[model samples]
Target: MEKRQLTYKDAGVDIEAGETLVERIKPFAKRTFDSNVLAGIGGFGAGYLMPKGYREPVLVSGTDGVGTKLKVAQMANVHDTVGIDLVAMCVNDILTVGAKPLFFLDYFATGKLSVDVAADVVKGIAKGCEIAGCALIGGETAEMPDFYPEGEYDLAGFVVGVVEREDYVTGESISPGDVVLGLASSGIHSNGYSLVRKLFFEVLGLKVDDYVEELHSKVYEALLEPTRIYVKSVLKLLEEVPVKGMAHITGGGIPGNLVRVLPEGVDAVIEKGSWPFLPIFKFIQEKGNVPEEEMFKTFNMGIGYVVIVSPQHADRARQLLSEMGEKVFRIGEIVEGRGRVVLK
Candidate 1:
């Protein structure tokens, strides 16, 4: 017989590496497990049990990727926090509809798998799921050599949640003089990094490893800080009050996102200087001379989210959200218009 050799590595996928990673992450993933979880790591399908007595229970699902912000994570070699960003991006959208996130799954793809790095990513995901009261049921790890260059990978997440049909929130009741309440973001919540990378690395010659003016960590760390999942606090308030509308400020920032839930002929007028924006935004604007209009269109700037509510409910909403440690503000009011968001 002719000499023949067979190798798993030769086919460009690392089975052993994937196995080691699953082993490393198994313990951490189990930390977020609850009674409903039906499968462990490496399973083909994740399983969960829906709770009983949720009248007219509706399933709310959302999936999102980290966008080009992954470039900053790869540049900083910081894999841990981006995993939280991945989960938050998906889960937060579910919350906008007054849903409770029940379970989550992730997909990580890379050129060559590193057990330590992949575990770091999973640890953050587990931490997020824990905080959000959701089970980390299962995930996928793909190692492809040709598709992605070495040391580069992408992350995506899917979240499923439940909401009673009677309690679901939409801006159907939003009317003129309804208050626009702003919630401060921890930092940039995993959006608009395409221009950020260009401004810092390409235009200004700043390295991701270098510390900028006010930020204590590398530029990438400040930018790559994980997405904040607001499911817990917001869901708590939903149980007590009707949240007329909510906006998740992501790629299109305030103008595009806040207008998403506005009823026709209702407008949101936001005060430009109501909440303080983080220093990073100023740094990029000064360095790159990016226009104010483009910045608002592209980045979240200062506010991560805004809740549209009746003026009567604004004070109570702020009080409840403030009790949860969020800096809430009365940034604007609704007015008569045709699906418009005005920054005053």
Candidate 2:
């Protein structure tokens, strides 16, 4: 008997497959490139020229993952849109500070690399970058045997954006009378999926394709609706109006995320019925018997982003956002109190 030596391929790391993936994704990534992207894909590090227009440029950066929503994508055999969720999670966070996203990178890891599935995911990421108007400069794809089960992969996204120091929306200007406006979410927008899965799988035992009259679609479609990217509308608003503060609703929900930008001695009071509640949320609450408070603190509950503006600008802001095709809601207002979020 002879012992054979092992190569990296024998250990399940396919350098060739990664190289092929890089080739497949180049055109897609190139579509998202602007003049500032200094280099193309497959580089050791991405290069970007500092945008020339800002008088006092401040680089803003954020990183995030799709959370367990990736599991929903895996179960449904839907690999494309979670990449959008990945980009939305990070870019939306940077948008909170009024930054315009400049470039994006991603990390993909799996036990086995399926070229088709990986390509589909990266195409979605590139599409997301196009929608957000950012360049996809570089990414990492790792095939680690035993690290992830076959047909399963995890994704993470990183984004760098820039804003002038004078234009950063820090919420410091959020005064007692500032109005809180809510932007309707596209379905759940990628949070609270642990509970969502528990309700749909454990309690209700619903399959991805199972139809519910309430959702008016398959169970997985509603659950996997890609996270909404508010960058365009928010960026436009920042240019015309002085947004006192902005909050991108994510894992912690409206109250959880909104409080981060509130000034001391001020609280936000959200009206319960100010916005049209999406049916999926009602279905979840009724089926799971989830508490009302938990619902506000856990899910976007239809509101994906919030804008704080002075009373004079609230109506105009709502109008501008609506004209931009957003579903806007005048949901709340700031009040004098210890920094807190109040859902009335």
Candidate 3:
């Protein structure tokens, strides 16, 4: 008897499927390319020319994953928006330091590669880069048999940005009497989904498609809302206003993230109710019986980004951001205290 021949696909790796995905994603990557992109997708390494016009350019980079939120997208069979979340999480962090995002890359890993799913995910990533005014130069897609569960994938994103060394906003300039302005979030921007999942699924026995009157949308729709990329508006604001400090509110919500940008001898005193609480937060609080403090610490609440400016420039900054289509709010003010965030 002759032994049967086996191939890579038989062992759960599909080289052809991976190749097809690359072909499908090339167009999506192309639309995001700018003059500075020396090399893009399908290369051994991507190359981006350093931007001109800065006397002293500083490179800023950040990396982050979608966390357990990917589980929700997988459960709903929705694979697109999480890619945006992936880009937003990384780029937004670096943006806090007044960096202008230059280029982005992604890492996608799964047990088996689904060409269609991977294409959709890449399309969303390209869309995010377009929104952020960055180039999606390259990415890695790994298919590991028995590593990830069937039909599930994980996403990680990396972003590189540049800022003039003299213009870097390190939060050291934050001082008493500076006004705190918040840029409203587009509903649950890619954090705290572990608790969100428990309260909606295990506790309430809700399905992804189920709709509650309070939320006014399906569970997956609200949970999968892609994170807002503030790169454009904030970058524009930086040109016309003197922004003393900035914070991208993520995992630690207001208290955890806001305090990072507070200099010693001053505290960020956030005025509660200064901004409207989105209904999803209200639903989570009411349904899960979660404490107010826990809710603020775990999720973004309503504000996604915080900008600190002097009182003289506060009104002008708010006007500029609002005109740029962001829901802006004067959420708090810097006061004399130790480096901390106090919620009133």
Candidate 3 per-residue C-alpha lDDT over 1-344 given as tens digits, one digit per residue, 9 for 90 to 100 = 99999999999999999989998999999999999999889989999999889999999999999999899998998988988998899889999999999999999999999999999899999999999999999999999999998999999999999999999999898889999999999999989999999999999999999988888899999999999999999999999999999999999999999998888899999998899999999999999999999999999999999999999999999999998899999999999999999999
Off by over 4 Å in 3: none
190-280, model 1: which lDDT tens digit per residue? 8888788887888888888888766667787788877777878888777666689998899999999998999999888999898888887
Model 3 — which ten-residue stretch has the worst lDDT?
Answer: 77-86
- Tell me how far the alpha carbon of residue 82 in candidate 1 is from the true structure, in angstroms, after superposition: 0.1
Best by TM-score: 3
TM-score of model 1 relative to the true fold?
Answer: 0.97
* C-alpha lDDT values of all predictions: 0.85, 0.92, 0.94
In candidate 2, stretches whose alpha carbon ends up further than 4 angstroms from where it belongs are: none
- After the best TM-score superposition of candidate 3, give how far the Cα of residue 233 lies from its true spot, in angstroms: 0.4
Measured with C-alpha atoms, the lDDT of residue 25 in candidate 2 is 87
Q: How accurate is candidate 3 locally (lDDT)?
A: 0.94
TM-scores of the candidates are 0.97, 0.98, 0.99
Off by over 4 Å in 1: none
- Comparing 1 with 2 on TM-score, the higher-scoring candidate is 2
CA error at residue 249 for candidate 1, angstroms: 0.5
- Top lDDT model: 3
Deviation (Å) of 310 in candidate 1:
0.9
